[model samples]
Target: MSRFGDPEWGRRRGGRLTPPEGLGVLTALIGKQLRARLGSPAAPPARPDLDLALPDSRLVQDALDHCAAECAPDIVAHSIRCYAWGVLLADLRDIRFDREALATAALLHDIELGRTERRDRFACLCFACAGAEGARIFLEARAASPDRVTRVCDAIARHLNPDVPLKPYAESHLLNAAAALDVVGAGARALDPADRARVLATWPRGDFRRTMQAAMRREQAAAPNTRAGLLMQLGFGGLIARAPFGDTL
Candidate 1:
């Protein structure tokens, strides 16, 4: 018997321990080694030219955190890119808008897609409607004024409805145009090449096209009669064929 009080303890078998390491210990050791090798995830790249001087309110930070937790990394990155693009476009066009409201709408526009309750609600309504409701509830809880909450919800709800004119509301138009630019390269031609390159560099696409395709497929599977499903069934093929980055899908 070994001095450790077990026969297997300290026993060598071909220069290896008789008893293997515990599963928990081995897993922890592996995790530590991997972290040491890779270091922490790098901070998201900055786009100084597109900065909008966003508000420093805790409510905005909470909304951003909620978005990050509810959405996939690529989607979260896309939201950030949307905000930046919206701000840049507004600047280019000399359009005045509520920067913080647009940012809030952009970040939370897809929050419903990542939530179980919201997905359930989608059985009867579109994701945009669910997202608007979710954003409203979230903002209302954070003590946002009724008017601000309404504007944010309106921007989110109308983002996917191209037929609902976005004019008269800078936030709505900016969010719609920005999302369009990211999704299918629509409206991208209006942006300066250098601006486009900067945004892409700051938020590297990193399989976004494929991720979006998979998301659309899932939506189609879950709600075949819904707007998203109908659009995918009817227009996705054409979109894929015409999109500048369609080959990526």
Candidate 2:
């Protein structure tokens, strides 16, 4: 078995690794992900002309307002970035989703990080139900959908696992991308400039824009399709380029 632990160990051991290197392994895996996969377009944005049914941008603006009022300014900024990325990922993947709900959920996923005094606690709570209350608070304030709210909560709960495999067709890929982005940006000490650049190249802006435009052209070449379906294709392509394990993770 790999030193990181066996793939099935998580299931057999209640998702806990033997010797508790599980946490360190998880941190290292996320570091490798950040070094290798973060920022690669997991999908393409919808055609420029497609009108997404996202809640008015004002909802995000309002969440930002409320977050700033109640949480630390750093938290507010991180929340905004997560929301923006979540919405973008949803848009790129063509997932028939409530954009407003996704953004609100993503933004608040880490709200409890503000409360944990220790790093391990912060990391642990970030992946457990401890943060659910905070996420619920954020979603409730905006009157978001309960189902979407639950999904966001679930994503937060699983954001840190080193052993859990991503559901192949689910939106978990986007959530994984977001979590790794943050960890790599902040905690990946082993990563150097060369490594970051190599990873970033996986989703180079020029390639993303070109691939997205091409996907749009292909979709429009046939009968028009729903905005969400098109985004889903884009997201799939992006994930193909940056997913943690080429064929497995």
Give Cα-based local distance difference scores for all models. Answer: 0.64, 0.43
Report the lDDT of model 1 for residue 101: 88
**How would you encode candidate 2's per-residue C-alpha lDDT over 1-249 as one tens digit per residue?**
321222123223323334345346546555755855445433232234343222567656665565667555444544554444444444454555545555555555555442434324322222233454556566677676777566666565554444334343133445555544533232222233333333333323333323333433443333122221232333423543553322211
TM-score of each: 0.72, 0.46
Index of the highest-lDDT prediction: 1
Which candidate has the highest TM-score of all?
1
Q: Candidate 1, overall lDDT?
A: 0.64
Residue-wise C-alpha lDDT for candidate 1, range 115-225, written one tens digit per residue: 434465432345666677778778989889887786787777656543223455678778877886687776566666667777777777666776677777776676555
| Residue 171, candidate 1: alpha-carbon lDDT | 85
